[model samples]
Structure formats: C-alpha cells, structure tokens
Target: MITVKVPLQEAERAKQELMRQGYFLSGYSVQKEGDHLYFPVKERFDSPYAFEERALEARPEQPQGLRETLKGKLPADVLGRLKTAYDQVGDIAILEIDDKFKGYDATIGKALLDTNPKLRTVLAKATGHEGAYRTQHMRLLAGEDKRVAVHKENGVSLIVDVEAVYFSARLSTERKRIMERVQPGERVLVMFSGCGPYTCTLAKNTEAEEVVGVEINPRGHELAEENSKLNELTNVKNYKGDVREIVPELGEFDRILMPLPRSAETFLDVALGASHQGTIIHFYSFLHEDDYAQADTWIQGVCDRAGRRFELLGSVKCGQQAPRVFRWCTDVKIL
Candidate 1:
C-alpha cells in the first residue's frame, strides 16, 4: 500500500472528492501528522499531493459495526450505552450519547467523523426536546465548535441554530408530502414552522401566493426569516408570536399545517379560525399503534364543536418515535 500526503486542512475535502471519484480505500483510516495528513491509495494520480511508495504501517481494518469498534478502542466499562442513529444536517451530525460515555465522547465523535467524511461537527443531545421553544440541549462532542446548520431540502436552503430551534431531516419526506398537496396561488399557513423548512420549501417549489409561517420562538422566527432570504423565497411571511394569536389575525388560509405533534390537538381551534370551508389542514400527532382512532376522534371532535363537517382526505404514518409510538399526519378538509 502507498500513502499520499495532503495538507492537513485540505485533507477532508480531498478525501471526500477522492471517495466520490472511487479512489479512497474503504477500510483504511486517515493518518495525520502535525501539518499534513496521509491517506492510503491504490495508485498515484495527478492530484496535488506528495506520494511515496512506502510500506504501510499495520493497523486493524475498519469494522462494519460502530459500537464494536468503539468498544475495542475504549475502556469496556466506560461505554454504558450507545446510540448508533443520528441526523445529519449539512456538515453537522446530531444525536444523543449516554452520560457514561462522557469521557469517551471525543473518541466516539472521531469515529463518526472518520466514517462520514462530509461531516465537520458532531453534537451530542444532552436533553430531550423541552420548554416552550421545543429546543433540545446539546453539547459539542467533536470537530468544529459551531451550532449553526445549513441544510438543503428539495432545493431550498434552511439555516437554523440546532440548539435554539427544532429541525429534523427525518421529516424531509413529510415536508415533501405536504408540499405536493399545495396548489398554486393558494395561501398557506404553517404553524410552528421551525427555521422555515416547510414554508421555504413550499414557496420555492410550489406557486403558493402567500406562505405565512407562525412561530412562537423568537429565535426560530428570526432564522425562518433568514432562511427565506437565503432560499430567495419572496412569498414566505414569518410571524413571531403564538399561533393562537397570529392565526386569527391572518384571516382564512387555503391550507393550514399544524406540525406540533405532541400538542397539535390543543391548537386545532386556532387552526380552524384560520380555515374556511374546503380548506385543507395537515395535522401531525403522535399516537400509539393500538389507538389508531384517537387522532381521528380528536380531530373530528374539534371540528364538530366548531360546527364544521370534516372530510378525512388521508392518514399515514410520517415517522416512528418508539416501538409503538408513531408520528402520524392526517389531511382533512373542513366543510
């Protein structure tokens, strides 16, 4: 095996480009010196790197299992638990690590970054999504020390502070699903629109005349406004206030999106106020598998109390949170 020495700062970018062109060794880890980084390559190319036909130092081949590799590298008792799943927003990787893995966070983070060269930072979630802002506490485990994430979805750019607001790449499909249902020249309202993912995507992809995103968190609203400009979306309007107060003032909308899964049921009345007859409402909620009827019942009950007939357009599982708990979205028309 031969090694190629690349500038330390350019190593990651060169590695990614090399991998994309099918030149990087799959099972080898990058070796670094103070000012230069070395990579194992099959043969020398015309790239800007110093190459030498030196015998490679012996090292263990990269393992397929992340946890197994970490266990082999760290003290056995330090890794009490491991979470292998994470959400990547642009160059940032977000996930939770057990408290027992505190001292080993850098090791785990290095492994994560080594495996995914495109990632520049890793944030370990310290607490659940709590408080009125629906924000999660996070700590920088490795790589760059920045929290701002620039995520692109369906050709729209979303700039958000992960710790200040809620952003989920898992909901990319759900966002697209909702965006497809919107028609041109229609006014849309997205309640609890975090960082303008839904609003910007809709405004950029669809011809919605006006897309108003109502968010209670001031920071989220600020980012949403920034994202709208970043994506060059002129139709997006961000309101920084409670949905209950903002929705009523916006009058009626052709389509309304309630994305707060845990507490969307409580805000149905306000959503109704912003809806006219034949208005489409996309309601998201978390429900157990056995009680499938709970979401429909609650939505229907809300419509009935408001003297409006509800037409169930569709119901589908958006994503799963646990074994039995699932995030479900229902599309309904108010008549």
Candidate 2:
C-alpha cells in the first residue's frame, strides 16, 4: 500500500490536502510511529512529506442505521415504504408505520430493538393526535409493555407518558433556541407545555427569574411538575388547567411561549392578555410555505382585539409537519 509519511503535527493538514486532491484512500486506518503518522493513499505524488510503501490495517465497518438493519429482514417493497425516521425518547423508540405494512410491525420493532441495544421499547403510532389533550394512542410493537419513558434534553430530565401526554424530541432545538433568548431576571410562561420539555428546558438552561407552565392535560401537568422536581429546578411552576383560565391570573410575563401548533391561534388573545410592554411572545403554528404571512396576520388580529401595539420580530421554521407545510414560530414583541 502507498502511504504518505508526515510528522504528527502536520498529519491532519496533510491528510486533508491529500483527500481533497483524491490521493488518500478510504476504509483504512492510519498508522502511527514515533512522532510520525502514515496516511494510506491511492498513489503518491510529489509532496513536502515523505512517501513509503507500508501495509495498513483496514478500519472497522460502520454500524448500521435502522433502515440498514431492516434491509434484509423486511421485503423490498415494504422496506421501501418504511420511513426510517423515528423519535427516540429516552430508551423508547416511537415509529410511524404506514397502514400497508400492518402485520410487519412486530418484525420491524424487533429489528429496531436488535439494532439499538439501548432501546427498551418500540411503539407504533396507533392513531393521530386526538381530543382536547392532543395525545396520541401508541401500540407496543416490541420490548417493554409500559408507555412511560424518561427523556433528557438540554440538561434536564423529563418523565413522559407517550400515550397520555404529547411530547416531541424533535423540538429540543426549538426549546433551546427559546431558552437562549430568555433574558436574566425575566419571568417566562409556557402555554400548552407538554410534559415540560420546553418549560424544563428553559428553566434549566436560562437565567430567567421564574418559569411558569400551563397544561390542560392532567397527565401532562403531572409530568411537568415531576420533571421540574427531577431537575431540581427552584424557579419553575407547573399549572394544570387551560391557558385561557390560568394565564390571566398568573399576571404579566417577560416572555411567553405558545407551543400548540394545531390551534395556537385560538389562544393568542390569552397570550396577549398576559403580556406587558416589551414582552416577547413565541407563538407557534402550522402553516403552508406560501401562507406563512397568515401567522403574522393572526398576531396582528389578536393585538388589535387587545388594543395593544406590537412589533413583529420575525419567524422561525421549527420543523416540518407535511410536504410543504411547516411548524413556524412567529416572534412578536408587545409595545
């Protein structure tokens, strides 16, 4: 094998240059000697580093992802239909399988468990989010029978009941984004806070004076309180009730978060009512790409009803809800 011999200090830079010029070979481990390194290459060209013929060990094969693990186990047609994207909440894997691949749930789940040794449970979405709580039904396809899982993100531990409460690990980045924007001594409110993912994340990561969360679902509220205690957060409070009923009584806030994407517009009046001058509100909604301006319109309408002047601070695309539709957060500042 052809190898480029360079000092340990220059090895990284030299290796990058070699790879960029199509000289470095793949699937081989670099060899190290006293104060020197040998990177395998396809062919030797004139260089500052010395060239030598030396045998090198092959690198270990990369671990297979979920789809790669299920390739041979599932039929070609079914495998093509399977979406590899899954939500991993703690040791639980939440999957969404198309109805056409109905009977293969167990097999798919087993393959997932086999591929991921850390996973203790595999659940398939039995139904879409339903009812007032927006909780979805999940079927146990493999592993443990329980639905409870401890999901940790942004330096906080959240105990979530996947079947009883709505939670999304996908929004961890969004939660962190909101947390970073929180100012010191600011009081933050999270409406429709499910299992305290956003509430706990903000309380744990930010310098906010206090963080209050309101959840209508009993299970979600219970877990939110539990999560606050679990993280040993002293500046956190969880309320079990509708935001419309609870937010007004909590008084004014420095910042407010409305995470209910499906119908967050319905509660904009409540959010605006609980805001004071210069208060920043992160209002989330599901809207198509072309109609994203509708979110700003909703905010304007609510501000008009409340007789409060406001400034639109722009929007963020949190995640995709459909092909062309996205979960958007429209940031607004009360004036």
Best candidate per TM-score, number? Answer: 2
Best by the lDDT measure: 2
Query: What local lDDT does model 1 show for residue 155?
Result: 69
lDDT (Cα, tens digit) per residue for candidate 1, span 1-335: 77788776556545644653446665666677789888888777756468865455666766433454577777666554567567777798886788876887888888778778778998899999999899888998899998897876666778878888998876876887888889889999999998899999899999899999999999999999999888888898999998877788888999999999999999999988888998999999998988767878988888789888889988888778889989999889998
Assess the local accuracy of residue 63 in candidate 2 as a C-alpha lDDT between 0 and 100.
36
The whole-model lDDT of each prediction reads: 0.82, 0.85
Model 2: residues with Cα > 4 Å off, grouped in runs: 1-58
Candidate 1 accuracy as lDDT: 0.82
Instruction: For candidate 2, list the clashing residue pairs, or say none.
Output: none
- The Cα error of candidate 1 at residue 247, in Å, is 0.9
The local distance difference test score of model 2 is 0.85
Per-candidate TM vs. native?
0.80, 0.82
